[model samples]
Target: MGRVRTTNKGLPRGLTIKDGRYYHVTTVAPRKWTPLGRDRSQALLAWAKLEGSEPDPSIKTFEVVSLRYEREVIPTKARRTQSDNLKELERLRAVFGRVMIEAIKPHHVRAYLDKRGQQAKARANREKALLSHIINKAREWGYTDAPNPCQGVKGFKEAGRDRYVSDSEFRAVWEKADQTLRDAMDLALLTGQRPADVLKIQRADLHDGALWIVQNKTGAKRAIEVTGELAALIERINARPRERLSAWLIQDDCGKPLGTFAMRSRFDKARTLAEVDFQFRDIRAKAATDTGDLAHSQKLLGHRNREMTEHYVRARIGERVQPLR
Candidate 1:
């Protein structure tokens, strides 16, 4: 005897209403529940595609392709990027979920950008980029033969962040920060690495009088020569006592490695105490600007091109001129 449907009366076969949301129940053993949507009409459209005579007709819809992308592609990205992609996917689904992948055109994409840009221009640009990638993958996977609609649809212009933390501002935060937070900040400033990378540093990464770094975002590798203040800082961190021994350079009182969230929380508290407006990330810009050499800053930041390094240090530093002798 087939499973009796008591609830979800008047809904289509294989679709059930749960907590005021529609879910599609798979026919196979160990059935999976796929969320259709909150809107009844949209859920019905998705149900039709799933139950259609065409084999796996769901692949033809933007929602299904996005699901596949989320499952297969998202996990391979950096942790931060994966988080951002999921948020972008949520926004994209609200707009394009029920639409046929092939039916999407440039105008639809532009319209999305125009509406979403009103709220957050930078975020809209990021979402459009994610959409373009999704469409490209859909084409490659044979879900759609139409050209990517996001192409040539211009995104809103965005300005780069130019906030620079001054020496006094940096000192104020440093004074308020605890020892662990101070170590993290020092590592960030000295190596010019990102918060994630700085927190992941291990004693093993230090060898041959250099601190080796494999950047999480770009996968770029750098071996920063250990000398002067950097060398002393590493020694001090290693000498610090903890309840437990860990290989990680940056650690809390318990000796467990500090994650980004903990680091940010500590930084926020310190920032509040210092009464400074500059962000933790601004320290990177400060490092680049203080270096005062384009080539040196480029190398220190491990940028693929000098242009990127220049952008980091630009607008924060004033031009130096010489008066007529």
Candidate 2:
């Protein structure tokens, strides 16, 4: 015999009979559940019992929430930011991928911070920040109702970089650098631009002794005037003939754009040869110091505000020391 069909003559407030089945309506999550039978009275009792109650461990695991975050959240960030987040996510997955979202506590965050801080304090701070953002996103997306574990964690004190490359050190690195590294180094020193912007420079970007660049991170457009040695160096790179010409101004032997890792590695090799203890970014400060003009350096570096430009302009020490009369 077929199942008994229940008529909705006196069903209670949270129970409804549709077709031949009775469903218990849930109040908390706005969902319906099957009571497995067609008895309207029993189903109504079940609905009343389950009303105003939370589901058992409705939160997803860390891996599940993180995957969702990677899909929906990470893509919305800038390319450089997205790359950084992915790296942080990789580290997080190894530590907490299998753990439940609600099970994470402040102690776990502190432990991660302590261990990572030992390696690099700045990196630890960044990871902790990223962790806080990810957990908050999880709550917002309904994956978990737990508090963010990283909220109680403290960031490390950052000692910002102030090691500007001196003229002597710059000459040493230049002498030791190969052709490709020399090209990159010259452009960075002349324009006071980031390595990313320097690598993205194309032959077509040059016009009438000036190179127009749109900074990737800040989106600031500036026309950098090339003259003297800078103009001569650019002319040399442009004059190189290729079987299939590349668009990039900074190219490898095969006429292709140099990858960031490759460029850094080559630059590092040159630094080691020269025994210099400064980074490629320090070239910007050196350029700013060489100009002795804040406004001109700010414009060449494409800084929207003078505050950031000031950071790159190092003071010429001992130039104004008062002698004892």
How many clashing residue pairs appear in each of the predictions shown? Answer: 0, 0
After superposing candidate 1, which stretches have Cα over 4 Å from the reference? 1-58, 322-325
- Say which candidate scores most in TM-score: 1
Query: Model 1 over residues 44-68: C-alpha lDDT tens digits?
Result: 6677688773236455878878766
Candidate 2, residues 167-264, lDDT tens digits: the string is 89989989998787888999888888888889999988888778888888888888877788889889887776655568899998788788899988
Candidate 2 differs from the real structure by a C-alpha RMSD in angstroms, to one decimal, of: 14.8
State the number of backbone clashes in model 1.
Answer: 0
Query: Cα lDDT for residue 55, model 1?
Result: 32
How far in Å is the alpha carbon of 64 misplaced in model 2? 2.1
lDDT of each: 0.85, 0.76
Q: Estimate each model's TM-score.
A: 0.81, 0.72
